[model samples]
Target: MSIKNTIKNWVLCSALLAALPITVTAGNKAEIGVVKDFKVTSQLASRDQAVRMFEGEFFRDPYIYLGPDDYYYLTGTRRHHLSGGSKKDWTSEGVELWRSKDLSSWELLAVPRRLGDLSWVDGLKAHSDEVGKGNARVWAPEIHFINDKWVIVHTTSVRKAMLYVADKAEGPYVETELSTTIDHKHDPSFFHDDDGKVYLTHRVDTVVEMTPDFNELTDNEFKVKPANRKMGHEGLYLTKVNDRYVIFGTAWSTDKIGRGSYNMYYATATDIRGPYSDRRYMGRFLGHGTPFQDREGQWWTTAFQNGKTMDFNTITKAKGLEKKKYTVFKDGIYLVPLELTVKSDGDVFFTPLDSRLVQPGPEEVQKF
Candidate 1:
């Protein structure tokens, strides 16, 4: 059968399966909703089935919240293993961005052109010899709302870390200069603490802090200690729960080379600045990551499970303080449920509730 027919059959089979309904409470109020449950089936599922339906390719580090618009924008390095060689030969497809109305259904926006796209090969080569070596390609693009505007933090092999600003999420994003400390910076994550302080986190020895405007760093800007002395090149999530700051990161140990082996881990700090302890493991054998809590209070961790599948694990509570794990069983984008427990002293623990797999409507699927 043609791929189209197979997809039609898959969709039909999926819809025919009954979904279990669950009640979701918002904050301290009573709210309820129904969701489907499914699991990834075949490796050969069409791109639409694997990604548009399953939200596979959209799994990148530093999933950032873009205001109360009920959307999270994520960006990551554009990889092209099929066209091997100097990274320069790998064209700047720029960065890929996705929009999720709910954490379950995602829409592909435009792949913004990188700074190098403004010129030709020779011109780009003149900009920096590193471009010739293919090390200057764009990597790890992150977006955040600051000073009433959306700002993007990204890296290029040539200049390392660069900043861009746009009035809208989708844009002809313009580049801006923030800092030039681009020695080993990749995974650029921006976070706004509860006290109105903005900080940038990335891999290099430890998560570093940048000036509020992201233009410069204070004397103690890079003084913050590392979360894990062993793990590097991972996502960073800063969330306030129960009035305390929580930090999440992953440790990579994949031997497959290129295929990263990362496991989800976290730590908590009384203050955003320093003195964080009580490190613990959340998800095992997960890599290239991001951990987030949805509006419905469902918590999820997105990671690459080797090169075969990108796993979205749902955290379920079996009892007090302990959590269970469920994979995105079928092939499609799913909003796994998450539960947040607030302590009287303001400490919060975000636990994964359950899995509610969602498939893209026929009209919503993108045509190649």
Candidate 2:
């Protein structure tokens, strides 16, 4: 089948599923109006299928930050509850540190810090409102353990991303006083390279060098967008496979809202900021995800299927992208195995596993 046809069929299946009458199982209550689609193929059935880590927790922009002690720390944008607040107000409400030695089980470590607690919250809010992108409220956050300190790089409704630091993973993290900044930044991604250098990818797929101290930016910044792409990049993610660096980011078509589509585009480079190859599309229905490695050194992606707010059929026709099979799953935290293959012609693409598994496991000594 042509790639376009595959994508078309996938979107149609999703629409059919959405049109079905909502059903409730005995004990599992569907949150956010979504029910888990249990009709997957037998080959995809997981051996250990009892994983549901995000149950009852707010879910959006799923991220698993691997800590220094070999534990996985998870967080996401919460549903907004503030009156007259933007969409991400809930994210700023407070952060709950979900810690686990494995992906299956999780426990909350109370490091709750509200957005109002940040000293610059008022100033940032005012600036974001002035810019007219108030909905960007606490959009996406990326946390890293750097230089023996826990650091969070997050963007608010404002035009720039801010840096916060604490002695341990749990905080009262204070904002880092920086001498340099990237204006109008969103979707902060912190990638620490194997050589001990850390790089940041933000709005527009721009990569910049950051000092290990997390105090300032170095004199380097460049957009890694492939010349063939029409839209800019957000939700920047980088991971090294073998000796090559795989860079991926989320992009949306701007023709219309819900009818529009979002997907991940990627390019490869040997160096962090590079002469990257042309862009290629991954699962057409995927958006705003991160590819992480487990303790076993296997590559897995924590990606969510985009919700029904917009459809992708029109976007595919408009964008001239290849027809590809769409895997329509419910929007939630998914743990899918990944296989990276370099095409005979030297093109690199990734194939994700069908089985969705959430492994279980716990909290140790407080790191921060």
Worst 10 residues of 1 by lDDT: 1-10
Please report the candidate that would top TM-score against the real structure. 2
Q: lDDT tens string, model 2, 1-368?
A: 00001233223423422121111123221122222233332322352221233443346676777777888776665443222234423434444456666566566554334455556655655555665334224545666786678877666444456677788776768877761244555677777777888787776567788888777788877767554553333566776765667778665433122233445567777766666767655534455767766666555566654544223334323332222222234544665566668766555677555422111001101111
Per-residue lDDT tens digits of candidate 1, residues 312-346?
Answer: 43122212111122233332233223345667766
* TM agreement with the true structure for every prediction: 0.61, 0.69
Ten consecutive residues with minimal summed lDDT in candidate 2? Answer: 359-368
Q: Assess each prediction's global lDDT (C-alpha) against the native.
A: 0.44, 0.53
Candidate 2 CA-lDDT value: 0.53
